[model samples]
Target chain A: MFQGRIIDTKLRKLSIQDAEKFIASSDFGASIFFSGTVRNQNDNKSVIGITYDTHDALVIQSFEEIYNEANEKLEIKNKAVFIDHAKGYLNLGEISIIIAVATKHREEAYKLSRYIIEEIKKRSPIWKKEHYQNSESNWLKGNPLVNEKN
Target chain B: MKVKIELFGATRDFSDQNILELSLNNDSTIEDARIEIIKYLKKNFDGNKDFVRIVNTSAFSSENNNIVSDNYKIKNNEKIAIIPPIGGG
Candidate 1:
């Protein structure tokens, strides 16, 4: 299964709790939960914060598509993919994205989890804007994984 | 034909609006539309070459939504988006 949400608030403790609850409730043999947090530095710069922006109509399909592709390519059966991405400003060390996956096998869970994160990086049309303590800002460069094939 | 291109992320800053209204020839493709947008950005916004990318309806929704190629034709009234690099996790 594929599940996703575009969260407008910072996610941290609550997101972890929710992920734990979700996997525990399932009968999967192994599971992984990944969180992408905003760090205080980027390329040696003291970053104060960052904000994520995305079109509401966009990338929702990207999430589902990535999960489905992972299921088929990884040969994993009976799996669940959950993704929650923040939509607005996030301070340093805040959780910007959370991903959880449950699968019938440990290896499959690990592989699928990595694949999902990479795919989200490549395919999702979500944008990040970084703010510096000096008030300079710029959009970081990103590329979709599928774009590499083109 | 004409299409309304939505601006997202850094593209919004370049266009100064959430949406960009541009016109194309009767059978213009996505690439053609992109050319027009780039031109507008260059002329009016001093846009540099390496800054924008296009994510069509296919970014999530359909098999038909291939990342636009030079010959990728566009349908009339289709919603196309001009976006900067996405930073989502």
Candidate 2:
């Protein structure tokens, strides 16, 4: 059985220690974690905050697709994946997204972690609005990079 | 009649929230609904011309078109989602 959780909350409440402990007791030999933080600068402009928006239904569907793809591509005894994103107002240094993957070996853990993030960025409908310190805000569009594989 | 208007992406930012409910007359069209939204938002945020864009239930729609046809009437509790162009990293 695969476990998935999606939440919108204050980033300060996220317990990294609890996540690490849970993965450790799951009998997994290796674990990988990815955290995306609010950057202070973008395009040489000082960022004040970010507002992330999403078509919630489409986002949830895309997440499920990514989860299934990760399961198919990785070979492991057991796996646990958690993705939490913050909506509304987020300040600098706050964790906007946290992804944790547990596997039986280091190589699979690393590979799966990278793959999941890339796919999420490529396929998800979530969008971000970056607010600069200069009283200007701009929306960061979806991936402009084309997939080399295709 | 009451209709549920769902705002997504940039539209949500413009409205400062995700969902809005509006009461319209029996003859209201999608264009009318949009106009009501535009009027409501202009009271809060300036720059009306640049913010005009639309997304239908399934895909993106133009500013001049009606989201629902005359034959298809929107009743109480019916939902329509409006999506602005998506921007993400």
Please list the residue runs of candidate 2 whose C-alpha ends up more than 4 Å from where it truly belongs after superposition: A1-3, A10-12, A55-58, A74-77, A143-150, B1-3, B13-76, B83-89
Compared with the true structure, what per-residue lDDT tens digits does model 1 show for residues A1-150?
666878877443327777676666456888899999988888888799888898655577788788777757878768877888888888899898888999888888889889988878876888888999889987776664334211
Screening candidate 1 with a backbone cut-off below 3 angstroms (N, C-alpha, C), the clashing residue pairs are: A122-A144, A122-A145, A127-B87
lDDT of 2 by residue, B46-71 (tens): 64554543322123222222333323
Error of 2 at A58 (Å): 4.2
Give the top-scoring candidate (DockQ).
1
Summarize candidate 2's per-residue lDDT along A61-149 as a digit string, tens digits: 66667778765666543676666555666888877777787887788888877887777776566678889988989776444222111
- Assess each prediction's global lDDT (C-alpha) against the native: 0.71, 0.62
Candidate 1 per-residue lDDT, tens place, B1-72, comes to 768877777666755667778888878876677677767767875666454343321222112343455466
- Cα deviation at B16, candidate 1, in Å, is 2.1
